[model samples]
Target: MPKYIMILLSIWLIVIDRCSGVSSPIKPFTLYKNSTELKNDTADLWWTINDAWKEITFELHIKSADWIIGLGISSAGGMKGVDIVVGWVESSSKVYLQYAVPSTNTTYHGKIYKAPTGYSIKRHAIAHKMLIDPKNVNLVHHLKLYECDPMTTLNDDQLPDGLCDEIVDEIKFCSLNFATVWAVGGDAMREFPEEAGCGIGGDYEIKYYMIQMHYDNSRLDSSTASIPSALTVPPRMEQFAIDSYCPSEVTRNIPKSGNNVIFALPHTHLQRISVWTKIIRNNAAMQYLFNSEKYDFNYQYENRLLKSIKLYPGDSCATRCIYNTKNKDKITSGCERTRDEMCLHMFTYYPRMNNFYACITVNDDSAGVLWIQLR
Candidate 1:
């Protein structure tokens, strides 16, 4: 080949090799403040390489901050016999240490290292602590070998049950941002506590849970039954109210005797029901009796006459009533005193201008009658 062509080919090969996973020297990482007045105290480190290198090292520089309290590593595939070297600079001197983490059979491994030196060593491993001043630290570097794949032949059975449990515990303790869990084998099941064990008020309580089950659909046998069903709160309990409608569609008749009373109707619908009270005094004519001039009337063919009380659909005996006037006056005043006293009725309906009405009742004699007309 021509001399120039040979040189160009060599350069291209080197570039390709690097791109195709050639191991290289340690990469320098840095942390900086967004504002000079406010400090950034959090950081994340990620290691991603398919091949195993001769040695891996991490160097850190921090200023005006406390020591790094913990360290963690996650294996996307699987890793074994991994060794790490950590080093730091303190009081103008360098401190370092080495540690090994056994390959986890299930999930990722998290280890914490305490300060190795009385003055807070600059670097340590597994569970070690390192000290650095936020203003003085300047350089952080990671060095790793780049030659052999460390996670190519991992299998599910190689993982330990405790590994998965550990992962869950970490997620619970550290408040991790994201997590993913997978189940292996046909018989394995994942479980979590229904209530947080801390016994605190803000603790998480998992009432209803759903999990996706995945298997080879084609391999499913016609005779093979599905996993037993789990106990779940009824859909009606979650999405709809148990007692949605109040004063259920029963009739209520206010008697001639004035009395303070409270009424309630059960509601099951998840929506809010409006309960209204209407006084229909015995006028010479029904039209004059319901006219707006005599009373602030909002009478609907179904449940409009009584406008203040609302009865949700699922409520049961959820209605309430209280008489405001004295017994003799209430029975004798406003056309309600005669054999046909003013009829006080209660109705429940939605807020729409003309929605389907749910329940209504008219007062008769000394009692009230409630009726459910929704069918």
Candidate 2:
């Protein structure tokens, strides 16, 4: 009799669980800058996103309907992480501001979330910072911001819960230029030099920057930006090294005008002791684009070069990473996971190239790829 009673109670609980509801706030309007609606044919407005990181502006003129008007921008629909500016006229004009922002988001499952670019016109970003929830840092392996063509119309606002890559069409990209690549141990802030800037938005032909956040049961997983499989590090070896080469054939995509490198971020997991990039021209050495005498996984930073290095046509670059795996009893291979390993050199340069997105590569076979001796 007790067993029968328990079965009835279990069925009742299942019904209650199925009846519970989760509601997300309504989708907000898309502000594509060129959008101007003369509300009932009486208003004229022109607004757009600013050059600074995350800001927007508006100017509206209306014949009537004067009580409250707003240009609201928020991460959530209702109130959480809101940055809204409202105004009205009666006596000396009044403005109401509600500003609160929490830069990170948490999740219970694996997913990809995207945020709007705010601006659809040419704007230059001078600096950017990584914003990860301190408690959930372990969940993030990498973050990338992709530049897409100017979006005249975005279907819906990806707020509260971001645009799920699984449910939607895989977001398309128009340019090879990635705005940023932040990995596991990267520094919080990265600033560009005074003379140059990364170009985006309309006119620049690359607008609508989308921040792509990758969170799985563990780390970042992007089939497009796949890191080369790691090299084998034998147990009890004094030192192990991995190299990645961007063959000159691949570098032909670089603009004929050439590139001036301003900053570099060299990344690897815990075993790495040092990392550097060697540039080559005419099959001969040119310079070390960037180098680290000692690397700290805990203090990973994107370094701004004091004096920029130049990369012309017919130039190629290769990355080398040295590891200390002498204490381990097992072999390690290059991989994307936090527990595995990687060898990557990400650099920032401008007169931003539209045709060439990356010389991106990894040299797995030492026999096939070799760098010229250093000058």
Candidate 3:
């Protein structure tokens, strides 16, 4: 996690609109809708974090499984390190509601990398260019780059430059802006009540808040989703959410293995009605940690065990998700998109195993390939 250390920092509360530069009253709650596609099936995503809005309710009057809806707090417009509560109605009529947050480490080309904070990335990139550009006198003075190295170069007066690069490197965006807090999901329609501790930093309190909604209609032709924040603030927790599977793009059968399972949530699209995570030893004896026989798509929740189960490194762990296919209709399966069925068990284990909390068994191919034989 400590791949890079970002040093100098200051808090910046975004009280005014980014575009309009006009200030609005800090309210107890806010609601947002996608104005671009207003006629779609999604509902307005709402959230609150004020004195009176301890218990925020989220209601979706969805008509079909044509959309994916979720919301949470974040420091910026992006999803990294955000605390999100997302849900979707699978084509199989199963509904799933989950609380999820993206890790700071992003996966790309089968590699993990850390991205800088959005503000820092944007601000420094501009500062870097202006420092090198001799013509940007206004920018140099505005950023106080002139204070670093005001002496003109002996070669060319116009070619001379302030220590803009050095000044930019000396300052950094606020570290507190990333604070966030959220819960996954429950049978209740409303979000769990939470206190408003957006930090008590007098005037410099971080103000940027972000909420995003994603709707998936890949199975069909289309979809839409919403929320907004003037200031960016991160959650206050630092814990890892890990999953045990194969390496990225690598597909391997679940060999006998064992580990303590603290929380388990079986994930599969609508084609599944039942899913199970069992610990198998010697390829014979089996112990179940999670099982959903009559699984409903709308009420998927993280089934946390009262105690962590013991698993052996040599013990094989298997996941079985059953889907209903009348045979009279068409069958869909793939690695990406909802039309294709998936079999994955999202688990949070105790006693950290490796730096990589989540493992991918199959890259981006049809896990449904295995489903074919199981069916």
Candidate 4:
């Protein structure tokens, strides 16, 4: 063990021994002389003292010729010019005396002193003021004092003027007067949707939904401006065209016995236009009953086709066709059709409850198919 650890262990052992009821002998000494000398009662223990001081020492006799000892000093007037010397017979000696004068209020106030070995000693003074109520303040007098406001009830009728008056009422009157002036000048704004809601047929039922796009169209070519011409109705609708007198120009795909179909379409460009060709099929024979064009060829802007349509799901009738125009001018002009103009039908038909697939062919001939669930 290290020397310091050994010394600590010895001190701990001494404390433990005393707590366990083992008592060591204490020797008292008075320092009326300038110096005092301590004698070692055993060979293993030694002691010495220098200078004037009143103190006591303790000695413990352990094994033969071995001893443990301690020293203490006490004085009613406080010790002065005192020195305590300690050593073992064959060990090193150490001085445990301080050569310092106790500080006095006037002598050491706000001053610093150094030891003989140049170690500095510092003294500080702290001043404090006691406050009973720190937040008590008077604004008019510009002073802080311990005062508190008494608790009181509030009366709404006694409130200050303009503190709680009807500001909103004034604003409403101004708005109405401005609107009346506008109406008198024939410059009134159009009826808002909320106002129009009450007058139309006594509360009509309106449903709103969004069509979400399911495919990416970043690869479409901007320059290809021609719609395909080889638009064909699904092959299963051939017989329905004869029975229903539906013109061959329209082809409709209806389910023979189901209530819904999973329809899918490809993401097409904004310039792409499409038409809905209706095909009426004979439910009994599963044959095409009629084929007809129910609506004008509708120009399908990329935005409309890519957006999902939210029609009445189970029994809704769709008579719209989508078409794309290569010419920007034609697109802007609502897909004007010429005498010899031709367009493609970009749709896939299947039974109402079956899976439906639709594809869009880009100018680069790259096509992508999308699947959609119909209810």
Candidate 5:
């Protein structure tokens, strides 16, 4: 073989090895930042820890104007529901830590069960409400085979009469309840396993973990941020895995109400305006899981909660994603293509158990396709 050809072949093999997870470094944590010129950018710091480093401590720093920065442990990528400890700098430069858990429907089997007999009252959709009552218990009730049309102009008559608890089978996303796990803050040394029985035990193992940082360059044009983060462990402990709640659909819209963990939804391009996921309890109380008022397609991250929110059997998870359909001038449906729109919610949460799954009203169509080929 030619001298140049041999050199190229060697480089190619090295690249292949790195891509195949063969060269993944065994480290406590790794830093990741976007090299792009975009002012609003993100940095994802991953931790490839195994059973050897189960109990460890983490220390982090942000270079400048730290609007959104955090350390997270995930099963998949950063976008998937991960157990993240997020922090934001206030106007007084005080940083506060909030435990965020991504919501996924996949963790709850992502299925909708039928309403038993005597469950009639009808389901209400996510229609526009000009005048909403603060104590209104009708809008957030569980619906039986309910449909929410994004373009529909909702009037007072379209709203539900009162709380409807007809549905029997609904998936609950209560596994990612780790508010008491470990506390994190700015420039502070935080320990994972603070003491004995502090870390996650059993068959759970952390396959992938990452730390993501978001820099906001709005007021200070040239201001910068940097975080010197670290994690230390005793070298041998059982690891735990983190999973999310993502419910996808090639067809059908989200149902009205059920006891499901509906966290966040995914959209492509400029069609989406906002996405809101809420939990409607049996007493007619409302709790928001994830809310993205100004949805941006460029920065598509799961809407996470500061703490884990539980859902009972009768409670339903509701999601509403608005779009700008007026510009297209054509009827749109769900598809993978860019021109088409998708109502898929990448639900993210924790506690990877056999019963966790999504609660969409339709059956998944992508199950039959082979995993090797490209989508």
Candidate 6:
């Protein structure tokens, strides 16, 4: 077991539409001619697919009504961070929907947020551009749009503009896979190439997406382009480094045609002095994928290669971030707050790979500090 645990209890859930009357205590529902049912001691679920509309409708019968029920699809493994939706009909009889990433959160006055909020894809579609929310104006410093696992079914409720702090259990899922990244003074949007895109309807469609925004109403440093004053950077060490990587085993999902990447963004908080990502093949350095010489926390944008880098089934990728922390004495590890630290590399690739959604592994990570049930 990990160091800490936070479990969300699931209570009884029932559903009966206003148009339909309740069933008698001794009587049970009869399965429709074309529908199927699954039942247990407390709940029964009936569902059927509408091929014509490409939709599936579900009805649930919970033995009790103490709590609402949430249902969605996911990978065979337990749902820690895989993109899935959770829905519940509140006691007010109002339907409530939310992204299944974590519990709904809120923002504070002086803190910077890196909230990964979810958005659902109604059908098969291709993403062409990712732009900063103009409404947010100078508040959003950096943003990353990540594609949830295609096989998952996640929800998207317009939760309040919230602060997204570090949730230990979500580190793996949230940091590994990113589809688009937009930073301060970046292009109008993160655009894709004409020849290829992430995915669209059918087998390649993404089910859900989460946009992690750094919400800090800080002005840009006009001269040095150094760390902004709004972000808290405590000096604790002379120098420190963080690393993130994708192993060769994860390359199995790469197709024979290869995966092509055009642009990459190596991200960090305020202290990084240098950053780089290297592609390794056959246990040797194949190419220096991206190396930011004099890293600047401000003025961050994507570094596009002259040509696309293609990777086959056996290739792997690694990234490193070096920080100068000589000023004060403080402890900081990987975290979501801009005041803390994060080392991540987000790149846009062509010909999406299904199972190869995420390959990042956090260095020196223990089991976890928190556990929030999403089943």
Number of clashes recorded per candidate: 97, 2, 27, 32, 38, 9
Candidate 6 Cα misplacement greater than 4 A, ranges: 1-136, 154-177, 201-204, 217-238, 363-375
Q: Which of 1 and 3 is the better model by TM-score?
A: 3
Residue 266 error, candidate 2, Å: 0.4
lDDT of 3 by residue, 91-137 (tens): 77888765342231111111111122344222211111111123322
Question: Predictions ranked by TM-score, top down?
Answer: 2, 6, 3, 5, 4, 1
Which of 4 and 6 is ahead in lDDT?
6
Runs in model 4 deviating more than 4 A are: 1-256, 261-276, 283-354, 359-375
Please report the candidate that would top lDDT against the real structure.
2
lDDT of each: 0.23, 0.58, 0.36, 0.22, 0.33, 0.54
Among all candidates shown, the one with the greatest TM-score: 2
lDDT of model 2 at residue 45?
A: 48
lDDT of 2 by residue, 1-375 (tens): 111110000111112112111121222144434334434454444445555744444445544333455544443344444444455443344443322222333221112233335667767778878877787666665677666544433444542223433333435442234678776677788877788776654556553555555443333233333244536666787777777777776566567878888888888877889999999999988889999869887666778899988888778787888888877887766665454577777788877654556654434366354332210
| Residue 276 of model 1, lDDT score | 29
Q: What is the lDDT of residue 62 in candidate 6?
A: 51
- Alpha carbon deviation, residue 47, candidate 5 (Å): 41
Residue 224 error, candidate 5, Å: 45
Cα TM-score of candidate 4: 0.15
After TM-score superposition, the amount by which residue 155's alpha carbon in candidate 3 deviates from its true location, in angstroms, is 33
The sequence of per-residue lDDT tens digits that candidate 6 reaches over residues 88-113 is 54445566554342322222211112
Against the true structure, candidate 3 has what lDDT?
0.36
Q: After superposition, how far is residue 244 of candidate 2 from its true place, in Å?
A: 2.2
lDDT computed for candidate 4: 0.22
Off by over 4 Å in 1: 1-48, 51-61, 64-70, 76-89, 101-375
RMSD of 6: 16.0
lDDT of candidate 4 over 231-295, digit per residue (tens): 32222221111111222112223343433221222211233333343333332223211122332
The weakest ten consecutive residues by lDDT in model 4 span 176-185
Ranked candidates (lDDT, high to low) = 2, 6, 3, 5, 1, 4
